[model samples]
Target: MYKSPLALMVSLSTLAQYAAAAGFIDDSQLTLSLRNNHFTTDNRESRGKIGNAAYTGQNKEWGQAFVLSYASGYTLGVVGFGIDALGQLGVRLDGGGKAGKAGVSRTPGQLFPLESDNSAVDDYAKLGLTGKARFAKSELRVGTLQPKLPVLLSNDGRLLPQTYEGYQLTSKDIKNLTLVGGLIEHAVGRSSTNDTGLAVNGGTRQSNKFTYAGGDWAVTPALTAQYYYGKLEDYYVQHFVGLTHVLPIANDQSLKTDLRYFRTSADGANDTAAGRAEGYAGAGYASTTGKIDSRVWSAAFTYTLGSHTLMVGQQQLSGGSGFYQVAQNSLPNEGAGPGSYYLLTDRQVSSFIRAGERTRFAQYSYDFAGLGVPGLSASMIYLKGDEIRTANGPDQHEWERDIALDYVVQGGPLKGVTFSVRQASLRSGAVSDLDQTRLLVNYKLRLL
Candidate 1:
């Protein structure tokens, strides 16, 4: 049932009068975060294709970003109402794409929006508003959202974070259970202020409705199970299942096992060749026929002892396609916008997911707290993927290595300040061969 706009306004006005005086204003929060980020990439083998500038083979960008967030506590009473707001601004310091060779020009959308001449904009800003209602342990939110579910992993890898326009309902009334469902209509890119429709890998055509429902069940204190289903109108349908378990050994040691599986198939337009001819399919390398048919699975094991943690994992892709998520360069006129995959093998420079691929990965991490350095950490990871399917050639393989270091101020005036560095190298037979590095400094201040 749909209510008229006037009716909604009237109902909202009534609820405003009953706003829980104490809870609504007392628990509200406002914060502002400052981020300074620098990113550099070397195109390795794919370099020098555009030979106009001296630095044709490399891409570098430095930017500063500010994010302001506000959340109001729900009003008291049988039903509560609230509002949330987000504001973000990003300024480019250096490195927007300049003029390249005659016919081959580089696009300028790495960390900022592009101008009419394909140059990066000096700055860009975005604003979001959300209205929320609550009853018991369930809440409903409408408008801007950043959902971090298996089907929708909001991207925050760039100078800014991505946002989606949608309505979400989450309920936790049952014991040890969380139920989630939502409908998303549009999304704002990580570095874009424009809101655009949704699509998959290499698709140019957009879809307006993406719906999902899921639930997480905690069977035992150490075991949890998850199931989710998602459908992108006229694109594809996906089903996911996950299980996680933890085995406690001692006070300082434990083992964790994580397993995930997904099944995806073509829907509406993607089910027909004619529709795919009109740009209804995903990346061609992911599916030779441009149709969605995939089965993906992964298993990871982690061991924690003292300040040292080790993790090992493996992932496999079956059927005719590789694993894919929403909003992968799907916008018609946008460069590579931010999109994230919630896979164990999703690492810096490479996701390690391709058609008929098998990947094995490992990581070692150390916490400096044990060494009396309270808020410092370091980690290294390596991944190797093999047997990637090709259209008309033999199978290929690829590998990637990444190192990361982070430090955070534990106390004092600069308490919420952090510094991080990440470097990654990839040698891939499927994707681009590149080396990437990122440096970031972040500080957060409470405004209310």
Candidate 2:
């Protein structure tokens, strides 16, 4: 069954009021983090359509973010109580032009809000709190959550991390087994001040209830398995299974394999055309409204030797619809669109998730520690996708290349400071040819 957002919030508030006993202030930890981001994208498409050309030029933005967080230890008792709080602020430094800013009423702008004239806003800020309680081997948290599970990963690919308001429970009563479940009612985008309901990709209708459950089991020392199930009211239901294993070959060499599978189907109002007409269906197909039905699987293998690693993977999508993931980008009058899915092919620019698509990818990475630079690393990757579903074409195809470099201060006053850069080039028949770049600097401080 589904629970209303109001009911959940009220229940949490009531429990927190009663749990506010002693030790609340004695065992708390606070931290602050700062991040600077610069983003640039160049679209090389020259199509004649106005809508296509809107995103066909240079788009750039620079911003900074400050995150303050506090977590309290449990109170002294059989069943302990605690609370967590988070505050975030984002300020834009450049890229205020209204020509190419992504300020979609439903989708998000790059790093700021869209004004009435479609220009970027100066700044945005938000605050969140969570009340928590713990038993012997189980814990419950209600309110703002950044879930990192495979089925519904929280998006942190921007100035601020995406958050959700909900109720979540976790248990580790059985050895090597971890259980998790949650009821999510609302989502806070990576660059928004308000919360919105949830929906599938390309969907305009919103659903308030998102229920999920999952578990992870460590079957052996080098092998672990995962399974999860998620459902959005009136939209669709999905199931995921994953496996990971590592085998040591030599003193410093090993091979790792990761496998993931997902099955999704329409539910409730999205099951038929009449239901879809009422605003409950996935978009991005020939007809613009299609039922959710897909089966996707991906497997990747990595071999590491000393400071070098090489990886290769392939992902296949089969069905009439693409992969199903929650995306609130089309909500009315909302200027934030943040969504993420757990796929090997999900990259900086595009996610190779179109229907009837098959993607092949390869990557090479090197650690500079062997060369006396302990905190520096570099990697490059290439991916090609084919067999895309299209209405006007026989078949569509695309390819992408990505390069990344990162360095962190190993010691000194800036011990935790890090710098990173990423560049991507993509060419496709379905969309456009594009180039994107990102530069980031981050630092964290511990404040008791």
RMSD of every candidate to native, in Å, equals 5.8, 5.4
TM-score result, candidate 2: 0.91
Q: For residues 102-132, could you state the per-residue lDDT of candidate 1 as single tens digits?
A: 5333445368878887788887877777999
- 1-448 per-residue lDDT for model 2 (tens digits): 0023244334434443443444565676767789999988777763422225455457788899877777878987889988887777787887776344353122224777677777776777777889899999999999999998887899888898889999999999999999999999999888677799998776788899999999999999999999999999888899999999999999879999999999988889998788898778787662345788899999999999999999999999987788888878777777776578899999988899988889999999999999999999999999999988876656778899999999999999889799999999998877778888999999989775
Provide TM-scores for the models.
0.91, 0.91
What would the C-alpha RMSD of candidate 1 be, to one decimal place? 5.8
Clashes per candidate, residues 3 or more apart or on different chains: 1, 1
lDDT of each candidate versus the true structure: 0.83, 0.83
